[model samples]
Target: MRGSSGVAATFWSFLSISSSVLALEQQPFQFEAMSVPTYTLPPLPYAYDALEPHISAQIMELHHGKHHQTYITNLNAALKSQAEAVHAADITTQVALQQGIKFNAGGHINHSLFWQNLAPASSVDAKSSAAPKLLKQIQATWGDEAKFKEAFNAALLGIQGSGWGWLIKVETGKEQRLAIVTTKDQDPVVGKGEVPIFGVDMWEHAYYLQYLNGKAAYVQNIWNVINWKTAEERFLGTRADAFKVLKASI
Candidate 1:
């Protein structure tokens, strides 16, 4: 009887250990490096106050440091979850995470471009003359700079809610055209053959603190700090060149 009892106890202990090993194997395996953040915020290309008078220092501080960083943080979290989902082959969780990834990724991409699209109001790069080739293209499309500004500002004001206004260079085979386009919420300007030459953030956080409810004034004054040099480069460069800002962040 004693021998039979000892054998039964050993069998049960072995089964328990085997079950624990199997359970550990079934859990998603994560590398130590996976715990580290996959994405980080890029430094502002210029000082927070550089676009002052047109865009306030306080707004820049909050928008770039707080708002933009939140997007990065959320995006990293979503991606980490996605990696685990992929490892576990959890299709349902992967699908649910798509919207989070999209929104946060778009926010990062748009803001990366936004910072480069601005310069000090007093800098020569902020002047329209800094973009002669782009100016010619704009003139051909909108008759002249003034008319283009009018059309662009109208697009900015026409946005029903939080969004963005863009001056995009569209290419069709051998031909190219410049168009004023708007993207709703955190959606990016990502159509094929489209290169975003410059973008104006229409989200209230972009202008609300300084301008109060005067959104039109914010639209009108943003041009004062528009980085024409960067616009010209994006206009002349390929779509890949335009998105290099995003790659650099990674």
Candidate 2:
């Protein structure tokens, strides 16, 4: 299996190429070589105060601007430092940078996705609230939506310390299933080959400003801002991609 640093390098390389292509395409006739792309903190889809009572503006600012930016910065530094070692096939240097790369890359990936996972309660339409397809899958897997929420919350509450609670889609042979899993620190769910359709950060920094020590309250209230529409889109898109891959393989 590829180590964390390898994964981080591959992910950033793809991002770099895509960005370079877009930059070149935007220009009329200027020919300029694209430099290596540095990972950046993606802007939140909504305003800082959008989540409001459920997630305070102060928390959003600190979480997105400060915390997430730190990860992006560190990730870029780690990748840059290890680039030559990685190209030289030096496993020792790669291993030494693995943890830092994983932590920062995972933080960047998770926080980027987390921002999209939320929306103002009012802005979420009835269709988003319904999540008909996801609801059926939830019902089939966990009996009902309420039961799924209960189980998911229980999983979040069970975290011994800083971690994340993720609702992921996994494929087993011909069958696709939904699973609730947790990852410690900033580790991402995608590392396990599962697509994270929804995730809630269980770290204190995510809620300490507003809920204090009440992790349960934070977890419960986060449901109010969850973008079910985004979750459904991820779920269905992953499934569709997997199907296309399977067909191509055949």
- lDDT over C-alpha atoms for residue 51 of model 1: 89
Output the worst ten-in-a-row residue range by lDDT, candidate 1.
1-10
lDDT of 1 at 164: 96
**TM of each candidate vs. truth:** 0.85, 0.81
Q: Candidate 1, which segments miss by more than 4 Å at Cα? A: 1-37
162-197, model 2: which lDDT tens digit per residue?
999999988665577889999999998664447788
lDDT score for residue 215 of model 2: 85
lDDT of 1 by residue, 1-250 (tens): 0134444544655575576456545654544334433667889989999888899999999999999999999999999899788777899999999998989988988998999989999999999999989999888889999999999999999999999999999988888888999998889888989989999999999999999999999999999999999998888877766777665576
Best by lDDT: 1
In order, candidate lDDTs are: 0.87, 0.78
Flag regions of model 2 displaced more than 4 Å. 1-35, 87-89, 125-130, 239-250
